[model samples]
Target: METAEFPAATSATDGWEPTLAAALLGAERAPPAPPGPLADLVAEADPGAALLARLAAEGALHRAGTGLGPEALAPTEPRDAFGPECPPAAATRLYGLLSEGYSARGRVEEWFALAAASGVRPPAWLFQALMLHRDSLPATAPAVVGAELDWLARACGEAPAREAAADGAEAADWAEGSVAERRAAFAAFRARDPEGARAALEPVFRKEKADIREALVHALATGLSPADEPFLEACLDDRAGGVRLAAQHLLPNLAGSRYAARMAARARAALTIESKRRLLGGTTHSLVVTLPEESPELARDGVEVNTWERRGGGARASLLRSILGRAPLEAFAEHPPRLWIELALRSEWADPVFHGLFSAAKRTLDPAWSEAMADITAEAYEGKVTGVRRTNEVLGMWAEALDLLPDAAWEARVGALIRARKIEVVLAVLAQGPEHFSEPFTATLLDWLAFVTRGSDALRRDLAKPWVIARLGDRLFPSEDAAAAAAAILARLPEEDTDRLRTQLTGLTGVLDLRAAIRRDFRSETTTGGMAQG
Candidate 1:
């Protein structure tokens, strides 16, 4: 009966200290012996057997106090009274010995009767044995198993008793059990009747001293869930901070709820409309204001804004929306882009705001609104502005404006023209520039042309002879001297596009010789590089 068949299962491993203290805990003095006949009967039932029962009992109580409870024994064989191989006659004899010690003077039978009817007494391991060995016991064994669980609910509150049960149960719950099996078992046990479990744990919650409550609560936590939110929430009023904190930690993930909504409402209540308009635009017609006052960290003194303001909002608003708090970007939408931009630069946007901005920007296309978005995107990329996806919107805007410039306007803004057309589009645009390029614009174009021609033979072919001549011809051939200079370059230039660049000094020669034509053609026009041709 005392066989240690499974050493690994029964032996304590390093760091897995048992709840010895709770087990050993008892009233300062021992309880009086069971009334008269029960004590005598226990004394007679093999003194060695009685001692073993007491030892097992003590071990069970210790473990139960630590929040681990024991499993009920099989009814076919009372583990303490008879080993597994005990014959049928021996089982009857063992049952007689157990019944005598438990029910002497009718007290045990009286307790059992009350427990069966009203379900208020403690569980008996002997009853568990009978239930476990149900096939071997009287057909009434189901009633016994049910009664044991009900009794356990009452017993769970008593530290020493609970500790004992916990100890006995720990071996079974953890011994080679799969997580699913353990979860299912605990779920089933707790579900049978939680009111009983609740009552049992209530006493443990209040009375038993030490950190035993930690284990008890953990045991109870396994049974707790969304259904238990009301109970856990009520504990928010607990006198014990640890208990309250535990309840609070479990509240968020269990209940599909959060503190964000409450915080957001509070933030919006404090927010003023003037604040929103100042942050965003005043109306659909007005451009976004980018107001300084809209900044969450705007200084009362109207002091000079620092780089912090220039980069993101200042610290005050940031901390409000950080990990510890909730800062919803939708909360700031009343403001226009400019205001939020100004505010964001001051607050530094922080990480959370960056995510919110990402959400908002993807959904809208307001320019000033989106420009502020650029800052957040840049920040998200860790200050690098290289990748296409990150730059897509901004680059797309620059691209659209280029395709619509008029000839006169394109001629006036050379830099703007460079931006509009691909290098291939430049010659076409130049031809439409009033048959003449401005001396300044022409000079800039010449620099660009020189750069391209020298860059590669592939580019030279791309800038075909006919195309280059058409672009520069009108300006160069206005007079005989200019025409001859252009012709001399043409003669030296490669006749075909496929010639080796080094073999055909054509493109380079054409660019160098154009200088004289430039000077000759513009001689009469106030002495600048070139003039408009009629």
Candidate 2:
């Protein structure tokens, strides 16, 4: 066995293998063939010419059992392609041929051995082509990919290395692909063996600055589960807020996610509405004052209220602090009216708000309070009408609030329409949309429609009406009033159509089980428990 060394025929500072491969393949040449057999082979291998043929043969052989990898093609006993010393041109030709031949035989171990012997650290472009041209490697080919990775890691030569490996085998392909695809790959790799990938990524995660760390963490998040929590927790205080936020976002989804639970507890206890009224500079009258949770109801419609009104200095704050101080949702439910609910919803405080609302609402089944709580949602959607940020914030609040309401109240109407049964009430209120067609108002309607369409079984009942059923199918039922309204309009329908409507509407009557509804309306509203049971 002779030692093989790649000679410096071309500048080795940067871009060697790929640049040479491109030129050797006659990428720039016209239709006519090059001078000899080598030229003919190069032309044939060119993407403009024979690349497709090679791919086809390789693909078929792969399906036929002659593909690459330990499973498809056995690794060849190691052999150096460039014996003694090889010129760059010879080395390039050898690598090209080796790539093609190995692909044909479904062998990459030979490619690995040759790459290792020549110390040929190909540029990303060349490496990508080399890998792509030899596309027989499995996703598990990271082992082979890593062989190249190791060379680049060691080569950290004078010039900057090609930024990323062609197939993105070096780092997770988080940046290059669609979110769903990248997410799946990242998650699968992490799931296969977390300790290995995470350990491999630790340095890059730590050393990379803010923006890079943010991207890395996002990639990591796709693979995140309880096993990754400890590491994510470590990043909570990362210098980059984005990194911190991404890590924080994943915390809640983890099993026994103590960090989120802890913060939620703290926020529930710490968040408060402090109110204070100061006399307008020169005027005798005072301005109304209210803090985070101090519902306008507490402040008195006409009068001002503030922290000074608290029995103990910051009573409002203390109230919030006390609320946050406890946990298990049950503790918060005992006093669900606390300002924290509104504040948490307003700011979209994910952990604290979710824990607080879920616990409180689950423990108590009353629907009127949920009805009034619904008002806050309307207010939220109304207040934050303009920007995308505000829209998200409002939507977030509405969703959590919808979750907290008694299942019945989640679909209940406010004011006069509340008297109607669930579907009727929802449709009646939805019908009011035309009377209140402002952008924010329209947003609230669409949002509610979407929620009712996609929410839990109890919530979905609102879409059961005949009109809605006709439009959205059995899954998205229409409201009763819509059905009634449709009936009233279509009552004059020819006997066949009316009979059809009657049959469709009558068939769904048994599906209306009021016992399943979880009414989550406001306490300020009627006390009739009709919706909750419905």
Candidate 3:
């Protein structure tokens, strides 16, 4: 099943070792992240399979400890000696953090660092809280998932949102509670009675401040439906710019929104599919483009005439793309994404059209559009296409489309990128991230990286480009096993030529090692020890 594109990874073409390195990638995972204390993990199994064993053992221990009677288990004294419990302040911090959303994810990672620094495992209740408040987990940031709760999300193909402690807040909480309490209350109420929630929110909507209004408006997404579009449309005129932006973003997703209808009108006026008679006697279809003039209506709907300026100057296409991007696919194109791509590629409007549909695909999450957009973006990166700039914005569009693609598609696209040795391209993709990279892909990516890092000229990226070499660790699996494998790079660097690179690599690897060490502490059966002050 492995592709031959990564020969440098499997064969010893560069006079480097490949046996231990083989375990470094393409398995279910890289080996268990073994830090100094658990350094022996490297000796126990191949790098790719060790993490599986670690998780299996942990799962068994978790079940046995939580389910079985205390008398049936091994004495806690031995377990306690090896692992220390997370300290009080850190434990409380984790409890507090669980309720926070993507905004506070950084703090959660810091909590892990502190707990790890203190050589302790996070409290068991923290795991429960994390799973309970799992909504806060970013669909990106795969590395920050410390607790093994991903399975719950994976099983459903989407993370299941467990209601918070305040999911059932009384009317008082919704009507007069603090902003925090109201968020949970409103979201919970919205999920069951969308209309009722709208009615309640609408009456007091004007009274809430700009920030509170913004937050409450975002909560509307929980029960988002076409019926909410009218309210959202009204929000487009709110005094706050952020609220206007939020509403502008949400409206396109509503299948029946007039916003989509208006955008569709603009699209029809701007672009048309015209038929032309060929010289040889056949007929051909052409996508003709004419950008719209700016107006108050366009501005009210959130279109900026200067999208071109912000996007580095493509005035006509930029304006047309704004219209096309906001309109739903059913209204915008008679053809499918692939055919539209064919037409787009032939026209000067390629990048804008492609980007516009990419935006639309993000809103709709249409698999067909996502697939075509992903392929086109990859091909652009591979230089098979032109006009689509090789910018992070384009890569971001690629990543967003990727979030909607199937796992198999993810493997195929990323596998090709790695095979081509598109280092920064791969890094950018991984940096923007997906829900999670499957085990085989994670293994393959890290394995290829490890293979390249050793003294091979084919692995030249680690030697020449700081963006490729230095930042490599940041986008990697935040585990001891992953870092330990990467640590091999340091041994191969020439002391004179790679001093700066060596320093950068050291810092990246150091962070991974610390994360791995923290994971090791968590893996041990925690018993009474010096509580982590973190």
Best by lDDT: 3
Clashes of 2: 40
lDDT of 3: 0.63
Model 3 off-target regions past 4 Å? Answer: 1-168, 171-193, 204-216, 236-245, 275-285, 306-317, 381-408, 422-431, 455-483, 515-534
lDDT of 1: 0.40
Give each model's whole-structure lDDT: 0.40, 0.42, 0.63
Models 1 onward score TM values of 0.24, 0.31, 0.59
lDDT, candidate 3, 369-410, per-residue tens = 878877766665555664455666656666666666777777
Residue 359 of model 2: what lDDT? 45
lDDT of 2 by residue, 1-534 (tens): 233333332221222232344335553432332232223333364455554433343345345553232232334334323222323333354355456665333223433344444444333434545444434443433443445543444443312123444334445564346545555555556666667667766766677657666666676765566777777878876777788767755665554576646634544444444445657644222112222355432222111234555754554543343233223343334344534345545453433343445444434433644554556655656564222134644554455545555433444433223333334434534432221223333234334443444445544444544354332212222334333333343333234333444444443332211100101111112267233211
Candidate 3 local lDDT, residue 195: 89
Q: Residue by residue across 1-534, what tens digits does model 1's lDDT show?
A: 232222221312211122222123322222222332223333435544554444455455454564332323212322231112222322333345345553232322322332334323223535544433333432332343443433433444333333444554544442125544443444445555556555645644565433443344444555565556555655556666556555544553342333334334444554333322444646422212122223322221111345774478554443333311232345556776545533333333333333334333433333444555543333423324322233433333222222223434545554554545345545433444354445555455544555555556666776554354343643422334444443454454445545543233454345334433333322223357444331
Candidate number with the higher TM-score (1 or 3): 3
TM-score of 2: 0.31
**Separate clash counts for every candidate:** 50, 40, 7
